[model samples]
Target: MPLSSLPAPTSSRRVLITGAASGLGLALARGLAERGDRVLATDVARARPDSVPAGVDYLPLDVRLDADWTSALAHVRDSWGGVDVLVNNAGVATGGRIDVATMDEWHRIVDINLLGVVRGCRTFTPLLKEQGRGHIVNVASLAGLVHAPGMASYNAVKAGVVAVSETLDHELAPHGIAVSVVCPAFFRTNLGASFAGADGDMEAAGKRLLERSRRSADEVAAIVISGIDARRDIILTDWDGRIAWRVKRFARPIYRLAMRRAGARIASTSHTIE
Candidate 1:
């Protein structure tokens, strides 16, 4: 079926966002609301996050569960009529040497990071196709492109997200629905709160990197909005994100050397707890 035409950009768009309790998701929700969008913020938290403002609606959604998606979308249908944008921004980071990480750990990471995105895409795509003019944005990471040592699960899932987004871009463009992958460097977000398989050393390394980067979620949200406005297929945020994209594209040797050094650093961190 040919998709319905999109509503005006400046008008209120019925936007469904996952992981909207904190960090990038929350920031994006607020930003979208500020742009005259009726944003529905969903997260695992039963109570709404403080970062979310008064106007946006908050609903409990565990992206790891498929039933939760159906319920959330049902509410959207009931209240807002239908959705125009879907942001699959919910994810968790797990850091560890692949050998030290157990199967359970791998499953937890993959289920939330990669499969969560898949679930959101599958669940919402029909509604989007009916709408005709909708966009799906998947939040990936720079680690997806430039490998991050010790963050095996995080790196793997994010890379999968990138691949999914790229593939969807080609497939959905004909349907008038767009897909974008957001590749952001270490940003000032609590993205590391759900560390499942990472050791203390790996955790510490991640904290230090996040602190050093100090990029705010609001900053990244602005970039994301701009990317969506331009209908870009790949959205890069922060200086490191842009640099990594360029390096991966034009300077493979330099990117490889950097990855090697990063691996060495992670290896040097004495494993206190696995």
Candidate 2:
């Protein structure tokens, strides 16, 4: 359905977005608030000045911690009466080939990127169910659908998120709850800089990819919020993301070949001494 035809979000729609201090989350918060929805913005770091829209309630939250989710949800319930939408937008990337990546890196990525969404869903679903109708937007990535070199851990977690969100869509649909999983190809954001990594090469590669990507965070945020309003099941933020998913679905052999070529290029570059 077209976004224009979906249910209009009004002052009665209460929204809670994680990672709202910056990037797509912040953009969505501002957009929703401008549309007159009461927004509760939460993030791990301190709230950014001028990042949140007027009337938005900003809360400090660490998605990795269950206590943080509980407190944030309570604050939202107390202030807004009930949450109409929950955007699980908080995530972190870990860079490096699987063999070279440390156990700590793998655990950290899974803890935040995958389990964070799980925790949010587990905590907020009851609140949403009580309200009888709501939306859950889980931000996955294009990498979640397709393999990418040097992003094994991050990809694994995001893929898990996609799977979990899809399952929840089925499970929650019967309860009048909607779930949308966002798969953005790439956007101009601080994700690369903020990604936890010890390897310089992996970090450089991540930076290079982020710089080359065409999408902006605002564009991604618009797509996400529109999808939520439309009650879409899968939200692809850009043409690249849509095309990538298509290739993965209908042209698996070709996609595998492309991945192999990219992997070969990385291997060749790694062999050359600096």
Whole-model lDDT per candidate = 0.83, 0.82
**Candidate 1 local distance difference test against the native:** 0.83
Q: What is the lDDT of residue 242 in candidate 1?
A: 79
What residue pairs are clashing in model 2?
none
Candidate 1 residues lying further than 4 Å off, grouped into runs, are 1-9
* Location of the lowest summed lDDT over 10 successive residues in candidate 2: 1-10
Q: What are the TM-scores, per candidate, against the unseen true structure?
A: 0.92, 0.92
Deviation in angstroms for 136 in model 1?
Answer: 0.5
Off by over 4 Å in 2: 1-11, 46-50, 271-274
User: Once model 2 is optimally superposed onto the true structure by TM-score, how far is the C-alpha of residue 65 displaced, in angstroms?
Assistant: 1.3
RMSD of 1: 4.9
Assess candidate 2 and give its TM-score to the true structure.
0.92
